[model samples]
Target: MTNPTPGQTVSGTITVAANATDNVAVSSVQFLLDGQPLGNPVTAAPYAASLNTTTSTNGAHTLSAKATDPSGNVGSAAGIAVTVQNPTPPMTCFVLQTSVTARGTGTVQTGAFSTVISGEVLLAFVSMDGPGGAAGQSATVSGAGLTWRLVGRANSRSGDAEIWTATASTVLHNVTARSAPAKGGYAQDLTVVAFEGATGTGAVSTGGAASGAPTLTVTTTAATSLVLAVGHDWDKAVARTLPTGFAMLDQCVDTAHGDTSWSEYTNQATGPAGTPVKIGATAPTSDQWNMAAVELLNSGS
Candidate 1:
């Protein structure tokens, strides 16, 4: 074949062409791939056929053509070898590596869990019952071999909800959440989750709530990202349902003080997702609650 010359690497759609001349008169020209008919014979000149390489396996392929004479005599051209090379798809990066939850009086800490991937982002959601506000009622988070930063906080008349983040390496460790003492002794629930493939701690879209639905609308800053939504409720006896299209990571309750804490995540693609990412939950009772949401970017996003 003249086009897609021997040893050429082809991808997507390309034209296959051949030159043929007969003593009598060439009635038609037929194209073949690997000795099989490629399509209906061509009745016009410039003997050529269009081929979509994606339909064939990504490997070596052979191209040839046949010309038919009025007398029924057919002549075959020598086959040319070519390689099909299509682009490989990218692999999914956002994945949950580990999760832990703790609840009780005084300082609450989750059990140690091993992180399987390096450069994973660690998240902590703490809900405590006591005086409500950001003053001395908020919770603080820490871990070994990691540095934690407060992303956002929400407060209710009966309790306070806080979110913290840390960039972590592969290690075995637990997270601690201690409520400030000035809150007059409190009971708290803490949930810590680790996710691999996140490049670093991203920006918080929105946070803080007094009561009612714990939802937030945010536009992402990265093409591929991991969006997280978390909520804390005054009714510790009930479990909060995650918003639609989100996967649950962890949820816990501090039964002693009647407070609940939970977290969920969704992986976004080919975006700076422009949709309203809400952590809309189904709460059984119309009680005091707080919610927060953050967007974490992926590597090379």
Candidate 2:
């Protein structure tokens, strides 16, 4: 055998067993799965084939090996079955930033600060890599005032891509690490929302009161917020980082779209370390209350 299994995703080679009579030379080794060929027969010295397994499906696979000898003669070969298992996704690394500076978990600081979680999406084109995207991606927030949101797609914008949005107003945006490794782990950018007032849903625009005054109405309270001025700790991950060498960047929100409010940002609290930032809706619309998007980046070979 020339090659062993790479964690259950490969099969060993067939070394045409040596025979003293006539230097028994093997014409070729055949591989079959339930009487089906997995790949072309290996004619070279090192006879082995890699198993094509992915995250979507992976498990024990029965494989049969048959060798053909010289002289119009076929010898009885031993049947060997090999198992193929699913390969794990890669873990790609990326830069982790926060909407608000002041590191640490909590007590580091407070206020309506935007934790701008920014990172570059690495593009990788490898056949062995797993799928990469925001299908199972998400984010969260914590503290006395904070909101989370997802926006944009990975590898779609420059380094300054605003993929995540943080709504702060007493509630704090907590940072979440990847739970699993994606295709080498994808690069991502997330912003934590913090410190804000009552959250409103639906639409609100200026000069809509017929008297040049701003007035809006919401049909569902699920898309509104009441707090404001919260700090953020973006770079929060949900499922896992992009595949190794492949990262995704974008944004998301925690409490839906808590932007459309009467006071919008009337009293946006101060940021930690004396920095100033605020989150509010500008001329409310149906989207200002709830919005989200995810961008994934593919890495190169």
Candidate 3:
């Protein structure tokens, strides 16, 4: 006999196989569950039966096989003890806004904060305000003991700013922002936004040409999970797309130059996990672009 070994746990439909022999000639073989007949006896070699494990109680059960010879002599194999287990429940993950900050800076600036929730991953977004539109300027944001790459940037009349982000598993993070050399101007303003309880990983890519669309791609290790794409550029419209098995959670636009407008677009969808997410956008005014992608591993911890 093979399968459903003693003390093994099983669920759903299971297969049981066995072989029997007799001196006179084996006529039939019968299978039993918990000492009761499983079904009609099998009358051939290589005996096998499909047992619906869901129909059995969620506990220990005994399985045995009986064989009968041409002379009507009967023999039974020792019972195998197995356990039936219930189905596992689905996992859930929560997204929460942790903190926000606004600071003035031309050089490197850092913002230190602690997470309010326990066992929560961290994501921080840093937007830098530049004078002559953030077109020729660049900003870098770092936190959670790791440095974040630029995801997207825009330089419109409404504002001249760039957005950067990073993720970490630590509860406390020190976010820093730095801008490239610029003409003598007013102190640039840096805005910081933090997200909690999200599993995030990201990468950065550069544009090949000076006036064409740049494509950024980031892949995750989780087989299935939530994903986010971030794109940045100067004086260009940005858009993002998830992989086949992933859906968008929420998207927000922030302008840090002049008006500092913030808008959110929320729509949920599902896509494949453990795949790469790609974001493509046009950058007409500047040659540089930064992109980041994050995936949430909601595997019940």
The prediction achieving the highest TM-score against the true structure is 1
List candidate 1 stretches off by more than 4 Å.
1-88, 132-136, 169-184, 206-210, 253-255, 267-273
Clashing pairs in 1: 223-271
Angstrom error of the Cα, residue 268, model 2: value is 57
- CA lDDT of every candidate: 0.68, 0.27, 0.50
TM-score of model 3 relative to the true fold? 0.40
- Mark the 10 consecutive residues where model 1 has the least summed lDDT: 173-182
| CA RMSD of all predictions | 19.1, 22.9, 20.7
Better of 1 and 2 by lDDT: 1
Please, what is the TM-score per model?
0.61, 0.22, 0.40
Query: What is the C-alpha local distance difference test score of candidate 3?
Result: 0.50
**Regions of candidate 2 where Cα sits further than 4 Å from its true position:** 1-24, 55-57, 89-301
Backbone clashes, candidate 1: 1
* Candidate 1 lDDT by residue in tens digits, 1-301: 5565688677777667676788878999999999999988987665678888899999999999999999999999999998887863344355566677777766776675655434678788776666645334667777646778889876644566777888876444333433332364677767777775577655575454455666666567766766776666765557776656777766775565667767777734435555455554755446666667787777641
lDDT of 2 by residue, 1-301 (tens): 2122222242222212111122567776665554666577655433444444342134555455565667745543344444443343332211222223222221123233222111122111100111222222222223333243333222211111112333332211233321111323322222232211112221211111111112222222121221121111112111221212222222222222121111122221122222222232232222211122222221210
Question: What is the C-alpha local distance difference test score of candidate 2?
Answer: 0.27
